[model samples]
Target: MSTDEDLDRLIEILPKSIQHIIETHQYKQSLVEIVMDLGRRPEARFLTHPEYLSAKLISWQDLDYSTKRLSKFTDDNRAGIERTLHRISCIRNRQGLVIGLTCRVGRAMYGTINGIRDLLESGKSFLILGCPGVGKTTMVREIARVLANEMEKRVVIIDTSNEIAGDSDVPHFGIGRARRMQVSRTDLQHKVMIEAVENHMPEVIIIDEIGTELESSAAKTIAERGVQLIGTAHGNSLGSLVKNPVLSDLVGGVQHVIISDEEARRRGTQKSILERKGPPVFYSALELNDRFCWIVHEHVDRSVDMLLQGLEPRFQIRRFDPESRLSISLQKVDSSSTSSKGKAMKSNKNWRKNSRTPF
Candidate 1:
């Protein structure tokens, strides 16, 4: 999916001087994005390097040169090249004039779910969580493909921001035979999520970035209605997610219940305890610790219950073998206050940090 051809599509829209420097540079292979600000020299972001793409600062003419070639920016300040996975986002001034542009490189990367395909075959809903650039979008695209092409299931992708599919009227080939229902705007993503199920009659609904409480509740409804769901969200761990009031319901949520004095004494715990209010909306959750390693919770209900009880939950650590085979090891997660496992359980980072995302 990281093709020179697709990269060229985005490169074509850039000002000629900046584009020439990008194509001639050695960092072209590792390029992640191109930054063009009104008064700053154009910069190129790579996997391990951020360097200037051009010596001259970007001018109003250069900005207009790129903007005219791209599709009109939406309310979210996002525009994309037609039929390409690349994205162009604008930064506007106080008066609504474009001041900067973030040209993000989007690729239809495959093999993002090499270890999780079997879980998808189980027909249970799954929740994916990770920080930005953890390949969540890439994995969901591959999931839609596997469910549609190999298993022959009816799959619908509620593509908000056109992340899962390409930014075109038709979807990308990476989705295989799955149908895509594009949302008109980011705020209407939940409505499109519900609409895809009711109108299309899909066996599996593939969505990306379930951020808002309405979207989380909508996911619950879809799961309750017997549709297999696969999507990504913002939270890092089960404990952290259950603690977030906005996202807690995605994993059954939690509540403080005061137990009787006798029960508290018998249980050897405080009278006030946190307990799950209902069954988890999704039965399984996959947490990305980088791209190759994943921490998988097979049963969300059992795992959440264990976390609530100040106990460790069991998870399968799936890593790409050095010999190119699947290397799986069982790991237990201790959710008692201080925690450590991987990216999903990082104590230093804000695990419950919420971002306003549609996909």
Candidate 2:
């Protein structure tokens, strides 16, 4: 089904007044989410800006009407429509009464992973880093479908919030044939991750929102067992992950080491320096700058080592043109350059131009 049809299902759950405005609004296609508060007028957030949906103040009656129609919110104050990706998060007052709702629209986008199709085929565990709402979940959903359906690999998803598949016993078709394991509580997600590998015997494991330290350690355990991992974490770049004490294990934990004076002088560096503790949980890492642009670090160990030394590392930038063609260019950051921007040095040796759209 098209995204428009999926959005229509989400629209049906809203109050009649807001639903009418959303159905007739000019920017309905680009709608990102709808916000409703107990005392304020309802607002519709779009890709560019937010607009008021109604003039009348929202009442408790309006909140009850929507809550009665949707599934029950979990311990995390989140709920979703069964068989659809749309997510509804609620805010409670001091008395534990629901006072607000944020209805976020979720669309199943195809052809978003064409730029990294080769990486999926390499069978190497990789981690994806990006800020919130940069389409990290959507990207991983498409990857699960492609790896399960096209590559014929056994893929299992560790769906913590039911965002990847949907809020239901049966998962949404966006995940293709990949099996999903739902976690009952947010704190128990790490245990479920380990359970999936111990019983399922899958070739690849897909995880979303890898935040806790226990989860990071579980990821390393899975990698050590020879299972290909496709996971996403919240960070702007590889440098940020290296500095994060909790998530640093995903790229290989960093530690301080002391070297002899003669060795430090030979390398022309300080006697004390930071170095990676051991092999990284993931072999490669990709930064999702946006939906269309991505920065790829083919080697996590090398990139972390370079960053620890205060030197710029080499990476690749992949982009999709308006025609849906994938183009890749290699860039190297010069450590000696005084300017803040890295010097651009393009490489055409491994450039790929695919004419066919995988979707």
**Reference-based TM-score of each model:** 0.90, 0.91
Top-scoring candidate (lDDT): 2
Give the Cα-based TM-score of candidate 2 against the true structure. 0.91
lDDT of 1: 0.82
Q: After superposition, how far is residue 206 of candidate 2 from its true place, in Å?
A: 0.3
Enumerate clash totals for all models, in the order shown: 0, 0
RMSD of 1: 4.5
Every candidate's lDDT: 0.82, 0.87
Worst 10 residues of 1 by lDDT: 340-349
Best by TM-score: 2
Candidate 2 global CA lDDT score: 0.87
Q: Which stretches in model 1 have alpha-carbon errors above 4 Å?
A: 334-359
Model 2, clash count? Answer: 0
